[model samples]
Target: MEDEVVAEKTNRQVVEDEVAAEKTKRQALDSALRCLIQGQGGELPPNVAVGMNSLEGQSRKDGNT
Candidate 1:
């Protein structure tokens, strides 16, 4: 019983850490993208669409579309 409780606690902690890390990463990426977009002066970076398209394609292929 004690071992099971410890394992459950550890699993929960790991999930919490992963969620925190993902949130931090997303925030950082958003900040960087915002800076890039704002600094571009009404023109998007050339690779922006390409990158997005690639991600969209991957998502579509993965049935997440």
Candidate 2:
């Protein structure tokens, strides 16, 4: 019936959304790892420096720092 078709479509959409979300997460992790590796020149990795800079920026924006 039409109801069954709609249900199937909804399920497919959910799966697609989950896959997209996972891809985004993986990309972020890969970016962070690359930054960290690049940051390894000093006491902290490059990624840590980038992360701290972002965190500081966010805190400033929120008026917390």
Q: Which predicted model would earn the best lDDT? A: 1
Global lDDT of each model?
Answer: 0.70, 0.69
User: What lDDT does model 1 reach?
Assistant: 0.70
Instruction: Give the TM-scores of the predictions, in the order they appear.
Output: 0.63, 0.62
* Highest TM-score scorer: 1
Q: Which stretches of candidate 1 lie over 4 Å from their true place?
A: 43-65
lDDT of 2 at 22: 67
Candidate 1 lDDT over 1-65, as tens digits, reads 99999999999999988866765675567557757887886655668757755755764564544
What would the TM-score be for candidate 2 when compared with the true structure? 0.62
* Candidate 1, pairs of clashing residues: none
Candidate 2: regions farther than 4 A off: 42-65
